[model samples]
Target: MHQETRLLIGQISDTHIRPKGQRYHGVADSNRMLAQAIAHLQGLDRRPDLVLLTGDLVDKGHPDEYAMARELLAELAIPCLVVPGNHDHRDAFRAAFADHAWLPAAGPLHFCVDTHPVRIVALDSTVPGAHHGAIDEAGLDWLHTTLAADRAKPTLVVLHHPPFASGIPYMDGYALRAPERLAQVIGAFDNVERVLCGHVHRLMLRRWAGTVVCSCPSTTTEIALRLQPDARPASFMAPPACMLHLWSAADGMVSHLSTIGDFEGPFDFA
Candidate 1:
């Protein structure tokens, strides 16, 4: 049996697998990135109990892409939960990963987990044919009821879109359409621990309604960060990366950034 006392969760988001099996940004092989990340996970001393795949598993919401996603994820030795982003096809995703339990099916895969001291809530914020994210009223109601149902366990909310903008203009524009409502819900709950998201293709952390909000980076490509206003945005010279999250009742949750590559140049420089 698994230990509910403390949990190690691995997150990989936004693979954007090219259907034709094309390379990304002319370097940093995409499929190989996933493979290498798995190897890295295997090397981890403390293995993750579960893997959360935030979104954008496929580049264009194509079945072929989801098929590739299955093949890539199948190499992992841990259980995984998947959600869809604007670029994903829900039906296709469901067909690909048929084993994932779907409930309160308003849309983008809403599920809950009682893994750690803090319960994990996976929300679907993707609206079909759109980039911006929104949690429908029914979903929000479910969230409210779900939180109200349990106040003992601190909760961590995971979604595909950042509830708030991440300072990047293009991505910020496509952020959660109505963030105040999200904030209000979290604010209402003293047990809400942290909020997790992926879509900006970078790591973004901010405080919202007295809770820690973090957005994980992409598994394949990263958007150019826009610290300064410019007609053009940040570039993708940076490699594909993900975040490994460690959670404990004694210490809370800690997220660590990870790259998706395996390089064997030099163990030691002499």
Candidate 2:
């Protein structure tokens, strides 16, 4: 891996940050776990060029929650890109990240970043008062234009909802609505390398839109992976994790799941 040609992007999702001193669902120490995730990123042998935070930034759409999220994110030394999830309030989220020039002043929080080796197109799929996600016609049109603008660069299309169902009936109930609409646009662009998402709270991958769609694991808890139709809704204190995406001109992109916490490792093999 040539250092100059390769770019490492750290992805941490579904942080679900709450007000200071409060835990997510009164079980997971979301704030502390996010801190640990940030520390883990900073301590990596090779630091990421930037970090992408897929959504569910807060448990509730509260200003105080966003405040707590901002405070925790401030610890990150590199630039962070964000998208809104079902739990986020658009107005409050925009206000919290007003400093980011890439964020639009109005409308859905969709934007594109082309400064890095790979292009990033972040879509806002949150429905104001609903847990299910959808991309209206206007959003799809915008995506078409954005993707058309640069067809040669390797791109990443990011959104809060995974476009495909996870087979977990309860979670699938809120999956992206009319995914084929988005797929049609994405399928046309051969430069797109991956579609990144986070609402699932579990790492998932699927082949869609001529590319790979990967959902990041949460920093707080893992939604129980029950695939049965009658399974109950639940979450557990599974080891929190994040994704590391490495891209280079020669290798394209490779993703790795990194667990966040203290674990014994680096033993000498003689």
Candidate 3:
């Protein structure tokens, strides 16, 4: 695959679907909001080859919520890959997206390694009843062993939480606990091209452990891009967004942020 290649992927995250088809985090019109996102993806000129539901597939680990989310994702023509989030119950997520084998042993994590030109290692970093994050020693070892096998492969490490701070005070507390260990593993691997995650409920791009890392905004709601903490949590905005990641064997990676509505922003740079 070259940079000009058309292997595009769509990314949706932090949906937080409610059991009664209720709004998530108090964001109104949850189903409509999600539907809007799907419509957006469908309208893309070059439809994505695949779609990744990067975590927070539901609000609670309830069966009904999973059912709702499952049906929602099934509407997409492409494969929708999922992993568990802190709010997601592993069993429910697996039961919902049952076709994708979660892990070798019974665990809440989903670690999928894409072995194409770019290797994507998806790790399940959810901890039940806990907001903070960490990949256990076993997960770390798995990452290490996987990375060790391929020295020249370009890799993308996808997970639920940001391994570092996004500077949002409230969300910062939930930052990956014991991130240094994870950093060490990342440090050891030179083949890592980037890392993608989706817990902040906002769009962000920054560097971590010498790799490009970013979070795609929610398909339903978004956390405000606050440089400083705000008393009231920021919520819904128009043009619910997802990301289009273009990875290639020759050109590395390029990205585009996809929106649900029209745009007029090629304005004069006056």
Candidate 4:
């Protein structure tokens, strides 16, 4: 398909950026890794039409952390959209990205963007002062209305937490509460392409809500995947990565996981 008919979206999630000069949990350098992810996106052969940050943008819900995140994200030349995560404070997040026109003045950081070939409906699943996620009645109503408004356009629904049980005990403990409720609204729309998420800190995919639910890996650490019910919570300094979703009128969306690091040569098959 022609390039003009395609829309490429770069997705980076769970950055968990901390204040300048500080490390996440006094260990992982989330800030530096985020910078590298931005560089990787910038250096891509086909630059993304836009970028979606699935949340946990900062380690803490502090204003200074948001400031640091803003500084690092400023390096990205592509337009970016964000949704609040468990680690984010709604008010602080709003104040940080106040300049973005798509952000609402108050309430959950929910909004829809129609400027591209595919429509974007970003939902705030973060529940204040909690690690789990949920969408209130109002948010659900808003989502139904928004999706119903543009049923023909391919759409992406962005949220912070995965809407399905990850099978990893620790992570599933804090997964989106009542996913079926959200699914009910999403399953009603056939044009809804994908439900993108972050919180699990690992890449995961499932078919739900009449669409694919893909969770992007964190740019800093990977949540240990232990299916045992008694599995402990742990993270590793694994290879960071990002997701590139390419959509076209003729072909549907195809996602690729791009590892964020300097690797060996890209040799030819011949």
lDDT of 4 by residue, 1-270 (tens): 645589999999999999999999988999999999999999999999899999999989999999999999889999999988999999999999999999999899999999999999999999999999999999999999999998899999999999999999999989899988998999999999899999999999999989999999999999998999999999999999999999988889999999999898888875
Candidate 4 scores a C-alpha RMSD against the true structure in Å of 1.2
Q: Write the per-residue lDDT of candidate 1 for residues 1-270, one digit (tens) a residue.
A: 965577778888877766556665556466667776777776778888878888887777778877887887789999777778878877787777776654433355788887555588888898888888999888888888888889878788889998886777766778898889888887898888788888888898998888888888886767886665454655574777778888787787788887766567546777
lDDT, each prediction: 0.78, 0.95, 0.77, 0.95
What's the ranking of the predictions by lDDT, best on top? 2, 4, 1, 3
Per-residue lDDT value at 248 in model 1: 82
lDDT by residue (138-171, candidate 2, tens digit) is: 9999999999999999999999999999999999
Off by over 4 Å in 2: 1-4
lDDT for position 257 in model 1: 86
Candidate 3 vs. true structure, TM-score: 0.89
Looking at model 1, the pairs that clash are 224-234
| Candidate 3 lDDT tens digits, 196-239 | 88999888898778788888887766776566666455654645
Is 1 or 2 the stronger prediction by TM-score? Answer: 2
Q: Which stretches of candidate 4 lie over 4 Å from their true place?
A: 1-4
> Between 1 and 2, whose lDDT is larger?
2
